[model samples]
Target: MRKLTWGVWLGTSMLLAACGGSGGSQDSGLEPPPQDPRFVADNAQWREERRERLLQPDGWASLVGLHRLELNAHYVGSGATNGIRLAKGPEKLGLLQQSGGRVWLVPERGVALTLDGEPVKARFELKPDTDQSPSIVGFDEGNGQLSLLQRSGGKALRVKHADAETRTQFGTLEYWPADAGWRIDASFVPHATPRTLEIMDITSQLQALPNPGVVEFERDGARYRLEALEGEEGGLFLVFADRTSGHESYGPGRYLYTDAPDRSGAVVVDFNRAYNPPCAFTDYATCPLPPHENRMDLAVTAGEKRYRRPTP
Candidate 1:
């Protein structure tokens, strides 16, 4: 297969200078380079799964539009059915509806939540935002609730709550290949406890995520490290860029999730699961950007490659 090229996703990131390196550039001292040229098969599997996520029954590729329901209104937007705004299936767009200071769905039944666009059947139980989890995945069609991304990642939306409109507008996730070289059997360097790291994003604004620690992996004969961000359910969220970036891949970077490593520091940093940020699919999202230290100099040739965004 052809050699994979990783690209920078969000913006022009200048190399980080704080990490132990020579001015965000080539190293004169780490381990030697690689001896082979193939991305491992395990890596490819991740990509296929990610692809299915976006194009299959429920992927982002099916996204049509993110209709903002108007508060105090009962009808769907213009030209919609019975004023019940509906998010279209794998082909159409749904209208956002608001009634009695709350958002309601069309029929509140037949309409489905597009996982990536296949239409998942469900509804958002409205609730008021408090310190507790806003969207606790409850069953009551109560008042004061919404999945507002800005007002807390839409706390009202629970896991598998259904009626997720974005699921329909999903775009396809592209990639180079699942190469073994990109699948690093990482060794985790633990911290005393989960530490809150102040990191910046694609927009140069600092965002906070509980970072567990660092993971060291080998590629092209060199040992590189990436700081893992903590996600819900003890999952590890990682953001990194490599040589292939800015060339064959997206210019900003890619994102990945991994199970927290074992005691011996053995965790599979699979690139196949690497996916495009929400920004890649829709503009209504405040997707977090990768940090400076997370940038890698080598090419990660696995995972969700890029989104083949068509002209709108």
Candidate 2:
């Protein structure tokens, strides 16, 4: 994504001022109440932390390649002649062999290599991210990282480089002004039995992830429901699309994380903390699209706006 320039920032500020505040359209009838000082400060801090994470050395922005392990055994490197050529790495990195449902890597003799941060003088087994401790091959003096990512289809090599253009020239992240009105209190309705949702990712792979429940909330006097997926640390993960999608937000959708529902079935769904998916930052990412049921009829002019990649 392109960094916001001074001119763009000035224009956005002017636009927000003209809109009589942020978070929604001037005529949406969902105008927020007086802004809370603490809410604004906390939201600002969250956005800052989000930005810093994306700018990290091996963050989403640093993703440079996703190559499938096609043949059973193949030479892998940045060289054009290699069977599995990488987008960025040493010319003759190593040879990867797959057999009996397992993969291993044999580093080239002279290349400086490390397997999980230790010197790699011999071939070692490569584990997929699904494992408790996935294997990582580091090269380029620690600037480049290689790992196996298990996708719906099969395992693929995910490459990230600290010097990737996406990271080195990261653009500014923009969001609607934080509003208390967007911080909605809702109810979590659990399923009678455990269920799964077939979510299609950017790569067109269908993933049957766990569907724990549904989050039902009221906005502008209209009730809406979003399917909730099992999230990290027992939280709730939501992928949703609103009226602003394609026009004012990422066309596919945005992601939100909320704490698990309390014993009383109450939950807080803070739209202000919604964020773009990894695909927004790098092409190498495979981000899930919002399920049809989660598409909202209302325009949520809060959270993130559509990202405009920088002009070459």
Candidate 3:
């Protein structure tokens, strides 16, 4: 874990104190459930389920390699001579050929692979994730899988191995205590014309994601707003940061997703549900950074804390 400099810690402490001080608006009549035994137990159960999902064979933690495809043919394997060398698996996996914006995966002789659980002995077209039914090639007897991913205006082979070191050696997640006070009622301010936000990902690639509107809420008497991105599931996605960002939380920011607004155009901005981006867990993930407008002046002392991997 990276230690926070004294100056940074002091600045964060001052910001937290200011945000929690008397300058904020009065309580908005929203009452949260008491912090009883049942409440604690429920939160514990949720965290457990989250951990289980992370350790899944194909989850983010299983990511082992991300190899950008070239315009020409390339050999993919664990061998050093291969164009895309994998960290694990057979020395000679297959060959990836790209032409005319299309990719094909040609299997090596006697190198067994499965497509939809059926043996694949011949070459087949590989579709990027942008397609509805992209090809998923299974190798290493289902322990390793490969798929085409469209990223940064190009295609790449994403490799997932069940025995990925990160997944096998994952440390427990830490969090600030579950505090219902962090759940605030917010109003959705829709834009007459929806726009696109240029989100810069960890890979330094810019993507234009949908910007539906803004969510306005008050905390500690001070009002704040966060631009909401249209979620794939008809919900709203928020990438934001506060004073806790560089000190007690993931330095970049945290992500939150909320259901669509109700009839009254009201949504609940639950900071308690804020979670660290996939980048926090694995370096292979390409996570979007928070936009300038989404950064908050106040401190959000809720949600998951900085994940410090346990020492060996």
Candidate 4:
């Protein structure tokens, strides 16, 4: 991934200013109470940490290619003849063969690759991301990584290279000014029985994700609710949109992860920490769209703004 340059960091304030000011005061026509200094400092720190993570070698910025595997065996390499072409690395990398709902990798004669730090000299099963222990094949002296990702009942090879142009040319992450009003306290109302929500991704594939409950909150004297997807980490994953979508933010939506409700059924829905999905940075990402139930009519002028990809 690209290094987080000092220019990007210095330009953050300017970008935020250009985007606009705190929407709360302007929308409500009433000045909000002064934010606590501690809250402002903590929020700034969180945004900084989020930026650092995105610049990591294996983060979303490193994603350079996504190739769907054919039912039959096919060569994969940087060569033009290969069925699956890589943007960088060896010319003749390997062969991907699919049979009986399983996929295997067969490295080229002179190519070297490793799985779990052990040299792979023979054909081995390649596990998809859905597997408990997915196999990550590394090559190019560990600067490139490859893994199978299952989507729409099919498998695709996700390729990540440290030297990807996208990573090297990362620009800035825009945002609106932090406002305490956007940090709302919501009521988590659990469902009597667990339910499922059919979420559609940018690829038009539908996934029946778990819907654990609903979070109800009020803003500007208007009530709203957002369906929460049960998170793998005992939290709640929210894919939502408001009036800001397609105008000031990513067109599809944004994502938010909040801790599970407390005993009293309370969860802090901090829009200040809401972030754009992976699709905002790279076209290779398969990000889910916000469910209809989670869409709001009000303008949520917090969190991340639309990303402008840097020139290569």
lDDT of 2 by residue, 197-218 (tens): 9999978899999999999999
Q: TM-scores of the models, in the given order?
A: 0.57, 0.89, 0.87, 0.88
How would you encode candidate 1's per-residue C-alpha lDDT over 209-241 as one tens digit per residue? Answer: 788888777766777788888855766888776
lDDT of 1: 0.50
Cα RMSD, model 1: 9.7
| Regions of model 4 farther than 4 Å from truth | 1-33
lDDT of each: 0.50, 0.84, 0.80, 0.81
Q: In model 2, state the lDDT of residue 111.
A: 97
At residue 69, give the lDDT of candidate 3: 80
lDDT ranking, best first: 2, 4, 3, 1
lDDT of 3 by residue, 1-312 (tens): 122234344344334432432223322456545776775677778778878888899888898988888659999999999999998888998889999989998998989898767889899988888899888899999999898988766887889999998899999798867787787999998888979989988677898989988999988788888889997566799998776775677776789989889878898887877888877778678789887777777778778876666567
Ranking by TM-score: 2, 4, 3, 1
Candidate 3 lDDT (Cα, 0 to 1): 0.80
Q: In candidate 1, which residue ranges exceed 4 Å CA deviation?
A: 1-10, 13-45, 56-58, 64-76, 79-125, 128-146, 150-173, 199-206
Identify the candidate with maximal lDDT.
2
Error of 3 at 144 (Å): 0.8
